[model samples]
Target: MYRIIGIIVTLLFIMSILLAALALLVSRISLNRHVWLAGFFAGILDFFYMPLKYFFYKFSDPRILDKWMVSLKNISNRNSFKKADRRMIIAPHCMRHMECPASSKRTGIQCVSCGKCIFSRLREDASKYGYDLYIVTGSSFVKHVIKEKSYDAALLIACDYELNKVMMGLKGKRLITYGVPMLNDGCFNTEVEYEKVIETLELFSN
Candidate 1:
């Protein structure tokens, strides 16, 4: 039985690798059908993603991976997000100003729109687009916020690593999700392409 289990695991690992390969090679890969399969074996792919990220960074363009992820997510967006009753946008605390005065709560950070950082603009746009924006400290809060609220779709902004992990968590839940990778990754003062964020928000807007 142990041997049989091992073989099954190995086959699943190879399948996930193949899926990742298709995402990288084919721009129009239909990811919604495979998301559940990928989620089932996400642990295997998650294990390999770190080294693969570095490999792409060193040998090829990292944008290839980012674009593929975005493309796959867009498929989900088109199918479910467009019809969502409630939408949320989860931003990261790392994007705040150095002396941000945002207060923490059970759900997440409450951005007061202090006009000290990019979040000020994001908060305004989020309000205009009718998205509930939450600034979170970590990935776990994302899960918490989603569970506590009735959101049908979410837009997340984070580093590639966190974005992938969050998407994995959302797999099989039937909730639509989109991610915007931060321009820089760190514990503080991270940045993202605000224009891209605006564009994505507009896509979901009527």
Candidate 2:
């Protein structure tokens, strides 16, 4: 499956980044050795990474992304000439309603729902773009939300492993998904990048 392949690729990428970073951290002749070693390994990936991804994607669940995209197109057409202004963003981190999904939550943990997480920002972006987006807080409840009414697209901010599982069950849904891998499996360890989501949404929406 593509998930298996993706994990391997991601690991390789991570490895390269670590190697290059360590090399940069060293100094002098030792630094030169580090740089040469890191560059050699990183080069192997740098040269073939994109092409490998292309192949992997080609071999992935062929119809899943297609279907999700189609659904979005349908929603867009439904509101043709009309501005789409709704949202279905997911914020897995609801410190108020529930404890942080994962990790350690101390006395300082708080969730004012000020649209701080990727969940809130994505929702805002969805409304701005005139499409409904779902913020799936829990993977256990994913089936329920996914089967709900016609959503234009989905923005999944979950662990890399969970994303792979989610994709495993999904058939060609014509979706343009942005899988955000959290630092840890749950809210406690979860960290989000609002700017990245914004950038991705801009690319996906367009």
The alpha-carbon root-mean-square deviation between model 1 and the true structure, to one decimal in Å, is 5.2
Candidate 1 per-residue C-alpha lDDT over 1-206 given as tens digits, one digit per residue, 9 for 90 to 100: 99999999999989877876654544334333444333323334444667767878999876555555555555545656777879889888999998989899878888888999998899899989989888899988887888777888889899876786787678768678888888888999899999999988888787
Model-by-model lDDT, in order?
0.76, 0.45
Error of 2 at 120 (Å): 4.0
The residue pairs that clash in candidate 1, if any, are none
RMSD of each: 5.2, 15.3
lDDT of 2 by residue, 104-170 (tens): 2221222334544544455556678655554444555656665665554455555554553453344
Which portions of model 2 show Cα errors greater than 4 Å?
1-91, 94-119, 172-176, 187-189
**Candidate 1, 95: how far from true, in Å?**
0.4
For each of the candidates, give the backbone clash count.
0, 19
